[model samples]
Target: MNSLFLAFIGVGMMAAGFALYSRFLGSKVYRLSAKYATPAHTMEDGVDFVPTNKYVLWGHHFTSVAGAAPIIGPAVAVIWGWVPAFLWVTLGTVFFAGMHDLGVLWASLRHRGQSIGTLSGRYIGARGRNLFLVIIFLLLLMVNTAFATVISKLLVSTPTAVIPTWGAIVVALLIGQAIYRFKWNLPAVSVVGVVSLYTLMVVGDRFPIVLPETVMGIPDRGVWIILLFTYAFAASLLPVWVLLQPRDYINGLQLFVGLIILYGSVLITHPDVVAPTFNDNVPEGTPGIFPLLFVTIACGAVSGFHGVVASGTSSKQLDKETDARFVGYFGAVGEGLLSLGTIIATTAGFKTLANWEEVYNEWSAGGVNAFISGGGSIINEGLGIPTSLSATILATMAILFAATTMDSGVRLQRMVVEEIGQIMGLKISALVATIIAVGVAFALTFSSGADGSGGMLIWPLFGTTNQLMAGLSMAIIAVILTHLRRPAWPVLIPLCFVVTVAMWAALLQLGTLWAGRNWLLLGIDVVIIIAAIWVVVESASAIMRARKAPAVAWSDADTDAPAPHHVG
Candidate 1:
């Protein structure tokens, strides 16, 4: 059978399994007896709270969960083969990610939209809450860095891709400015934003503006990193509707078209899939099917990062608590499906192209100009699309994917700064706090990995790290539910399993880097190991605290922590 159809069967099965796991038996996972439940706190206006519609909440939650991590992680994991990747994406979402996401959303809603970190304090323990926040901040910086790199790499291509990319950036900025500052109509401004981005692609085909791979003898990769950070700085400063959301909407269209083309190629070629499900040669291979895969595909699975979505922007805007269910749970399911589609493309559709090795090399070229040179053959053969257009389409998809996370990372960072500052009793001006946040964001973009830096290596690691955050959150939720004396089995079993796997994955990565003596990778490994240990340690401690603390029922709008760092 053709791989596309095979993919469909596999994905369909995986999805079916997820439903069975989530619905009939999930409450047992959450240990969800009403007695074990969190109180559904009421909302209020101002910084403390605001209500929003589930539709919008779903949109925000989905976009927040959709980031470079899911895309890159699955891509890397699938190198082992689509089967294992599919299995992890499917099973993990059904059992691990779905439960984690629902638990976080439900818990946050119970506590007046308090973030996971803060909720850790109220429900888990004060020290546990601070600890969780530290892990979160580190995870955030890594995420921002990875996505920025991903965008930079995607844009460093033919003049066609580069020009449209830069144009989109400028256009996104202008649209954002118009909407937020000038009070321009949202609908009209979004239209102009789309036109402007598309126009760059169209006009560039004629004028053909390109950013060459290198300038002043700098490696093209370095140039992309620098430019990426510079742009992230500005993008972070702007309002969501303008640059982030509008750009994502336009980019989402590109992702949609690219996926379609990829699926179409698979349908036409019907290539037999040869990729293995797992690679034994890399033994000591990315720790087996537990935390490793779960962590590697965090966004595609369940990400604690979404807790920020549940509590931050989405919660602030939520019109009702019931909306949290679909918005928080199902929207994540949608992104999981999207990533599954890409996995299908990579396994089934990709083989049709004659020279994947060559395409891989091209995609891995020295700078922006490198891919342009290698584009012709792959487009003609494997992808079976015209080079100029396919190149634009592919490049646009990467940019858009990266853009989604950029917004998420930026917003999370802001909340972190705000949250930590409040916890520390530091009264910093909002402007100065923003500057610190921006600077931290930029630093992440500049960091690198062995084969490549930016998004490629870092993002998968980011996924692993992100998954750890999810695992930690799930563990906290399970522990809290248990301590409160409620139905906690469903959440605990998978939550423990996922986190255990994730820890092994992190350990393996740390071992790999330590053995190789690769400085950048070594640094990443060192930091992740530290963070994971701290989170695990704190989580264990939190459960102990929960077991010990008298039932301290939560009240709405309670401001909090003893120095924010140790909260979660």
Candidate 2:
């Protein structure tokens, strides 16, 4: 079949979901209203909680949650064949991810923008909240640490991407200044920011920057990792308006532009999907298609990490309560589209079934590299862009995606650290929390050796870990809905589905880790499995408590915060 069919089907399904399903969720379920003041206004600090335009906020939310996972997830999961990946990305986005992201945002908005980890205490009890925080901390640690190595490796391998990748930081800073400091018009500023970013891509393609194998006696990859974490530390310390928000907003727009190039290329070229919809012949060591497929494509489908990003940063910047549907649900849709595009690039970018088989000969094969090579080929073939430039464009896109997520990951890590401190009755300043966060990420990054590859040591567990987080976040949201006396079926159904599959996947990973004698990961996996089950039990008990107690009044539910920062 022509890849265009997959593109059209995926895009159409996601669009319909966003248009119809999201509206039902907003009106019938969430009942979002502008009257409820968001934390951005109530807790406005000109830093983390500054009120943001919904468009800008959407961009920020979209890009931060997106990261490189949407691309990497689908690109890898197509190893099971495109049909399962496509269905999960589309259906999961509409029903699973859309609701999960939007619901968590609304839950946080009503609660004064507490992280989902903190919200656990109100609904699930103190012990559950601590366990929740541990999962969140580990997940963020994995993200910040793994992504540093991912980005550093990319910088070293794709030297042409280095300039545009880092050049985006400068573009974002200028965009932030223009929008906030000078009060410039947003559209004009966006055009300037995007143009400047692409111009750097061109310059980067013309004059690539290749770091030597050693820089001041540090290996190139190690140097890049250090630089990346240092930059993340600095970015975390800045006001969101000055860096994080603008950078993410612009990168979100740029992703759309990149999507148009990719999807549009598919439209013009009309390449055949050389891979089968379902692989009848299984590759050796490939896990069963059912649970693994779900977890493998977590981000595009129904990632728990989205819950983290939604509750951690997005809720705080929401200008109005009603905008959650757009920022959270549609942000999910944007990622679904990216994942769909990745499915196409990987399955159809090759010339034939034979060529595709060569790349998909094993389960571990196909990811960002496949997306870049194949997507680049499609762009070059359709738009007549040179392959080198197309590769540069895609490489830079991947790098920027990782970089933005690293920025948010570090910041979220800081928040989690501070929350943990609060639980211990210790007052940790933001500066100190950020240092601890960055320090932890750095320690993990270099734990294995000077090459900074240790970050990926626990990466085998990320898919399950991320999905488990989503499940836990949804549990918190469902509990909140139960308290409000609203129908929580929307949240409850996905909650059960994701948690079951994630737990199953976690257990499966335990077997593999045990066989391999990887005691460290095995121990970590055992702890996560135990903690997750404990929290789920506590959440179930909390639901019973909410049911037995008096239903919370809507007005009271929305306005019950004691203080801005102390709500959690």
Candidate 3:
């Protein structure tokens, strides 16, 4: 079948899900109301609590959550075949991730913009809140370490991407000044910012920048990872409007443009799907597709990480309660679209089945490399762009995606650590808290699994932990709904599904790690399982208590009510 046909089918399915299913979720399930005053307005503080435009907030939310996981997960999970990956990205985004994100955002909005980690105290009790904070801190730490390694490896392998990646940061800084300082029009600035970044890509392709292995007698990748964490530390310390928001806005626009080019190229080229829809000839030790595929494609389909981003940062900036549906649900749909593009690009971009098989024969060789080559081939054939330039552009995209995630992850980690400190009555400065967070991430990057392969040793835990986090967030939302006398099925159903799949996947991984005697990963896996159980038990208890207590006539839609106790 022609690649464009598959693209249309996938895109059409996602659009329909957004229109029909998501609309139903918003109106019937979530019942988003414009009447409620958001934290951004109620707690307007000119810093983290400033109210933001819906469109800009959507861009920030989407790009922050988009990260490298969506691309990496789908690209890797396509090993089973495109059909499974496509279905999951389509249905999972609509039913699972969309609801998860929207519900958490609403939960946070109703609770004074406190992150899910902190909100656990109100809904799940003090102990639940403490455990949730620990889980969130570890999850964000893993995110930082993993993405730092990912960005460094990409830069090392694709030297041409180095210049453009850094160039985009410089552009973002300028764009930030233009928008915030000079009050420049956002659309014009965004267009110029994106165009300038793409121009840098062309320049980079012609003059690739290669960094030396050692600045002063150190491994290059290690140095790069340290430099990245350093940047994250600084970026996290800056206010949201200064660097984080503007940078993510520019990157978000770049992603949209890249997707259009990719999908348009598919239409022009009409390439064939050389790979099969379902490949029964499996690798020897590959886990079955049932639970493994679900967890493997976490972000593309329905990542728990999205829930954290929703409740952690995005909820604080929302201008009104009703925008949660748009920012949360549509953000998920946007990720689903990206995943669909990955499926199409990987399955059909190659000229022959043998070439595709060779690239995908091993998981290590596939991932971002395969997607870049294959997607670049399609763009080259369709748009007459040189394959080298196309590959450079794609590589830059992957690097930026990872870098954006790292920036946001570091910031979230700092907030989590500080929250924990406050709960424990330890007075920690923002600088000290940020350093501690970055230090932990830096240490993890060099742990025993650091086999010079860019933290691949700890990657297995990322997906499961991410899904478990989503399950935990959804559990919190479910209990909150029950307390408010709202329908809890929308959130509860997805929570159960995520917890089941994640537990299964984690157990499977634990067995392998135990046999291999990889104590670090094995220990991490056990903690994840325990965390899942703790959250579920807490949620169940909260639900039972809510049932026995009198309904407090609490409506999230009430805009005139006094705000809850402010934490940060």
Q: Which candidate has the top score in TM-score?
A: 2
Model 2 off-target regions past 4 Å? 556-558, 561-568
Off by over 4 Å in 3: 448-454, 555-568
Point out the worst 10-residue segment of candidate 3 by lDDT: 559-568
lDDT by residue for model 3 (1-568), tens: 6788878887887778778877787777667778778888888776677787777788788888988888888888888887888889888987888888888888788778888987777777788888888778878877888888888888888888888988887998898789878999988998899999999999999998777767776577877787788889999888787888888888888988899989989989889988878978655666689888888888868887887788778988998787888888888888888888888888898989888888888653458877898889999998999999999988998899889888888888888888989998998888999999988888778874332343566777888888888988888877766665678888888888889998898898888999999998898788778877887898887788877766645566554322222211
Model 2 Cα lDDT, one tens digit per residue, 83-154: 888889989999999999999898888888988987888778889999999889899988888888888888
Output the lDDT of residue 458, model 1: 52
Task: List RMSD in Å for every model shown.
Answer: 6.0, 2.1, 2.5
Residue 248, candidate 3: C-alpha displacement in angstroms: 0.5
For each candidate in the order shown, give its overall lDDT on alpha carbons.
0.59, 0.90, 0.82
> Which pairs of residues collide in model 2?
304-470
TM-score of each: 0.76, 0.98, 0.95
